[model samples]
Target: MISIPICSKGCPTGMLSQFLLSRILENYPQVITNKNVFTLLQNEEFYFNCYQIASILKPVKELTNILEARNANLADCFIGLIKLGAKINQIQPGNQWKSIIIFNYNRRLGEFINNINILAYWLHPLYRGFGLKQIALNKIYETASILWHDLGNSEESCLNLLMEMRYWKRKVVPYDLSFNSIQETPMKWWLSINVQENETDQLQELALLLFSIVPSQAVCERNFSMLKWFLGERRTNLTLLKIESMAKIRSYYISNTDKEIHFRNKNLSEDELRKSIDKSVVTYDIFENEILERNENLEQENLNRSEENTEDENISSTILNINQFVNLTLPEFLSTGNNLFESITNRSNINERNERGNMEYNPISLAQRILNEENN
Candidate 1:
């Protein structure tokens, strides 16, 4: 006869079982008659080890939850990984599991950290290129320029984009405004820039494109899962058009209402139903274009990776510098009352700003004044 394991190892279930087993041994020793199980449950060291493992895994669990969220983006993923690494590094040196956890973490982190994530981290207004090395920053710029060219922009426009990025980094003129209102909304902040120059206009468009990208395929996977539910065995006869209409309506209703949609057999007017579907439906051409664009981006990314492999040393150095900078600055940044969740959760601070008002708040001048005060 095959034996079924009581609990799997290295999981939350195992941790819970360990805790409960300890309690069970204390309360009802007669329940667990097996001497081996009894001996294991009674061991205080086992419980301690379980607690240690749980504590080590907690930050990783939290990071997973954050990344799985709908609003989570590339910037969140980048920062989350950095923070996770930092938290793991803080584990007591004497802890037996510390070395094992660090080894696994570093291996996984190397796989996840790439140029796209680095670019997203640099672009986010909260950090604003704060912790990135010049080499890493240059790589991001090069990536952006390449993407710009691939999008059918002229050489002059690409150069202009590079120039505009410099102004943004240095907080010059229109870019130097107090952007507290839209600090969390990077796309909106980029859109809100009212520069008359064509060069800055390209920057705004590029920023929007970069920030609008979702970090993972979770949303797409979710949609497919929902579609599967909608097209169960009984509903297999439904036409493609009808299925598309139903999916769009269901998505719209759930997004706006945040409630379960119950479909009931009713005598609905065909005209009204058609109008609703038409409002939510996307054109087939648009879907095709999106697919093509994604394929092209994937191809470009593959090409970029092959080229980047030639300069692995520089890339490795850049990553090391980024980690060091994050370790040093993240605590100070958090101490200033700004945090990761604030950007995700807080939306009340977003305000409409006029061009004149935006131009009035010069962050560069403000920084100079602060420096002067400190020198005095």
Candidate 2:
């Protein structure tokens, strides 16, 4: 239910009213339906007395049964004004007589609302009671026309108008008036149509559309909001896959929730990336007799430099591992196989000798430190 502050009043703006109406319709369809909307007629006095938009309505209907309506006093008159609306054709001085109202204490009253609504064209406020019933009704027909263009009965639906007042007893003042001449031209101009604007149906349809969106997404969003509430400014340690999994799980159980994850892993890690990239580096050589025979010179120099055939073991291990990494860690790079980490971390090369006081630690940082110290 849309709870509004009970204070000095007026109908809210169109967009805000539309939004509120949608929310209400979404949550409470059965609460307010076509049948009950007319129940508003039970309180017409509020409409005529307090409705400020009387300026726009041209004040066609008189406040007849004032003694009968609750809260009919002028202090809360605006509330009644909100209950009613019509198209303004022009502004007449003040014949504000009742032509018709839909519900009646008796048949006389129902006929009264309908007639005044019909003659509503004659009652215009001098300033802007400009849009009368025909224009108002035509607005509805025009909108419905968008939805029901296939119905195919366009000609007879035009607004047929006439001038029918005696000179001495004329109700027309200085408001804009329409005549039968409008329908003479066969064009589809809105003013030319006799349709009266009744927006409740259109508004109801729109409300239905808005409500059709599921509660599940909203629940998901709320859950996400709660999750974010638990986590603070610090970056979370979850990988994208884990975070996504959590989001999916929340959606599966909840309705009308939302999640707000902050961190996105986009950049590559500094330690693993190598500058000189070549596709061939990742490709595995099967350690065939031919490669061993072909690189005899390179193998001899390697053996002379380090008594540990460990270097060759490391090289062999590196080649074997690269093929594995290409196949397993990143099959996409299998074509190029030029990854640097795979090239450098050879099986034999991975061993560490503690040059400092006989400590044999697996020092991954040793090579860089030694090279830097020697250079410095």
Candidate 3:
């Protein structure tokens, strides 16, 4: 469907509309070849009326798209409605079209737009420009009076909110920051600066509340769609915690990693994680073994330093026991270090004898076997 802003500034709708009309007029008689249909298409009045109506409804279509946008905020909705209202007021009746029709349509649209609280527009950063206009400014002040009593605050607080709003409009907010490209929301921007300057500003909090309201259900509807896709048809029985976890993951995570996700289990260790993982999980045994070896060596060096400080024979015997434990674990670690190249390129009978299953801690034999394998 052709969206609005179809007739927005610099749009090619005029040329495209002309092209469409021409194509329909030229192709109807030849392509359709039906007398009844051709007779209907031949009506110049019908085509001209359609063209005029399309031109008139172009801005309305753009307004609808803007309101229905998922990312549109409360401020954006008010700003868009204000622009739409202005565009409607500026529309002139064509010679053929009835003035009553245009007037009534515009009136009805204006009335509907009036239902949106003027404070919404007044609070928005972008619409402050529109609020300064004679007609809109009066309406904004009038709306503020009604909303002031409803704020349930002391008269002093209400007056302060208005004063803060005026300062923001005249001094703080710039014209260009109204665009959709702005990364920070109006409330966030205010809070960042306001908290830095004075943390207890009640007016800043009030303004934040006013600006935080969304103009439409577009964001809610989008989240609902995401929920449906995440759960799928068959997973209707999923737990709420699981569903929420999945939703959060979908929102935050862009890619998968080998790291396991843990919640509140702080004491879990690497060995526990390894044991819990599926046996089919691929292991980079060589890399893991190298890390383990480096860690063990560092521990040994630290222990040796402690032994030097003690000058005790018992300490030296404890170090010898630690070295034996390291050797015992190293064989199992190396056994898991499967190399494709070792299997394919180094198929020697001598090494096959050396790779005896679950051998006792024997560093000398292991070193000799490694040397033989490297020679081959």
Candidate 4:
């Protein structure tokens, strides 16, 4: 069997492999003698199933890519999940694959989504709580109220914020017919809203803050990677202040221009260099305490989540079982381990292959054994 390299985009590999196998079977009939291979690849229904599966998963793959983007926000993630759910719901009713996908999607949604995500979705001008359930709307209001109070706003201000939210949702005057087009970015539109009244002030502030938050830590991870390059073995003695200045300069240059910045540029002024160094020094002092406080809050949140998980061990176990069941039933080739079927098909005898005195790993057999064990 020829090995096919999996594409990073999606499981187009199934269709590609199917086509390859068909061509091979047609050209070199003697190459494949296994009845299982013929049945799996030669049947017209097999082709249709592969096509259906790919079509169904296309939107999910797109959503995953969107959410992984550097500029993606909580609102983008929340809206994407809701749209993906709706897309899944539109699939043929009796599809086993659809049911499994939906089950896993909902499980992940429950685990990952929080009040902040809901609030971000609600605050997005494009979505404006569209397609959200009444319960979700209530949760959004609750989260907004809590955030308002946390920011040290008075109770009266909190009430005003909620009222403004209602007005915004209904597209009332000031919130209605914005000067900017709806096609503009949500944050830009929020900034452009020039209502003379101060009723929506708190809501605007909160929306901007929420929209400013990146949905993922991709930027931080990239910065860490860049830091590793800067702190290589030859540069181990570099001071933190110098490293900070270098990182900020690199970031600014990257943001402003596609061209690379030369460190030895003769046009650079001494005053500009001194100013940059001084800015990093001042920023380090200014943000150090805020960073510490943010870390403490993150630790507390993790501790609370740990406590909640411990209290709901039974529920967690049940979810685990459901996950296991879904993984067993779904086509394993579509997963990260695309070589499962290839390994099984290429091996004539499982006993012939041994790793560290253990039998060869066959997911099909393993799944059956697990099912039997669970039944017992």
Candidate 5:
């Protein structure tokens, strides 16, 4: 696959090509017997086509590899996609091969990449729609505005947030947008910039949200695999809480460097130690017992509360019935009887029946009435 781009040109511009030609000549002379066929292998145009294909696809392949990584999150791929798109756009025109390359490249891009992903790419600290044409920048800003508005912010507020972010990027950040060092991850980088200092709370929040999102489900799929391994045949009946705890513990150990200690243990083989430790770490009876105890306490509390509520309801019912009996008589004049009834109803603190399903124009009731008339 690595050799694909240089297939026609070969290493010395002739290495692999020469080897394949030699093999054909030695063992399959009849395959290329035609004069045209023989000349085609040596054709510069054919080699250039292969090179063009290779060059154009290389970045796409790299982006796929990055997204498929188990631990990779959105920030990595967002940066990568933006860079790849820029590189694709930079392909020189006026050349026939360049046009073909651009068209094929764009067609593939359109098939997979959508505006949402592009918006995410453009929002990155490294890009922030900088260096992009005004049209592209406006599109990115429009999409971002829609996203923020969808998340419950008003359109005006969303636009204001974008404007604030642009200001922060241009004026607040000490480093250039194209900073290549990138010593920290996107989240860490934004976090290091004190949220209170530059009034960057909103911008930092956006960056963290974007950074936390993953481009692919690879991390999720990997975690699922871990789940399967931990909850083997023996632990199939693990409760949701237990499973959650175990997963968190496993993930913590993995990220905290403690899990790597096993690798450094020379005396015990990894498999042998893992088998011995599995019972203690994986079974985790203490956590299960604590969780069970906590649940029991909560259930007891809920039962007591329900009993108290029932007693209160009994007292309230008695009081309500007596009050209703007293208020059932007609007014002396009968002129303001409606107001009297309203006062009595308002004074009673009873829960109302849900009337939503019994609307005046209920279709279900109308259908039932029609069916009854038909049957009659």
Candidate 6:
């Protein structure tokens, strides 16, 4: 017989809800359908599709086998999902059979984070909805299988594995705190000890949620509290850049935002950097160019003296090596500082200004953009 749906008390109106109503008709054909579908749903919530009945049956057996593999049970999955604030009535597909997701307190601080967390708290579907439903079913099956293997034995071996799995799962589950009585306390205490010993970033995060009921419920609010001083309570028209800047500033302080601009102009241009290192041994110093004629005369006299009598060959070799050592070590020795980049940039800027002053051409054009840009 063809299946049709009428409105129900529980599911007021929705396509999927109607689809479920139709499914009820197909399952229990004996049930009178001319009445409103809501009446039928109120009478009974479950419906079976006879044609696909065998398909559902085969997996239950497989699920039984998996549960026996480990000492785990439906109750354990139930408890796990319950701690995550998921309702019992979910019927969709996959792990989403329970919609609840376990996120850390820090993760739920965003506005959208609260929305998602709220949605996760709703009822589960009968079957997992996505393509991965079968896979999640298999995983849960595997989890159950492993659970049974260790459930009765209590050999400490299986129990330990189960405990560890539970521990890991609890950590992954968002908003779940029931398992904390078992392991969460000690883990937190140990963490506090670490925090006391050394003030690390993780400690800072934990400190934010020491007494929190939900993940970062107050964190976003607290962050925005500062901005409230600058903005109205109802203001929602902020530009993205300003909002982002405020967020970054709140998160990391001033050092992060100014770091780029601080380095941009402060850094020496490639041309200036290359010219600073006098690569040409034969090049004349600009200041010394006026003395070139006078130096040439002096050099001729010195050459005559050198041709007549020269120093030892060993002495010349030693002088050459010493010059190389000075060339290399002098640059290195001059560069040492707490922040090499800042120091170098400062020095470069000063030298550049000096160079601009000494240039024979127009100072405006000769000066580096960094200095002249501000001037202009």
Best by TM-score: 4
**How far out, in Å, is residue 6 in model 1?**
22
- Predictions ranked by TM-score, top down? 4, 1, 5, 3, 6, 2
Error (Å) of candidate 2 at residue 128 is 24
Candidate 1 vs 6: which has more TM-score:
1
**Higher TM-score: candidate 2 or 5?**
5
TM-score of each: 0.52, 0.15, 0.42, 0.53, 0.45, 0.17
Q: Tens-digit lDDT track for model 1 on 37-118?
A: 7887777776776676665566567667767766566777777766666555555565666666655565467677887777
How do the candidates rank by lDDT, highest first?
1, 4, 5, 3, 6, 2
Tens digits of per-residue lDDT for model 4, 172-200: 86677553223466667676667576234
Worst 10 residues of 5 by lDDT: 339-348
| Pairs in clash, predicted candidate 5 | none
- How many clashes show up per model? 0, 53, 2, 0, 0, 37
Query: Looking at model 6, how many pairs of residues clash?
Result: 37
Q: List the residue pairs that clash in candidate 3.
A: 4-62, 5-62
Candidate 3 local lDDT, 244-347, one digit each (tens): 88768755532322333534245756456434542333344676667777888899999978756644423222111112112222222122111100001111
lDDT of 1: 0.60
lDDT of 5 by residue, 13-71 (tens): 43365556656766677777788878877666766555645554666666677677544
* Cα lDDT, model 1, residue 8: 48
Better candidate by TM-score, 2 or 4: 4
Backbone steric clashes in candidate 5, count? 0
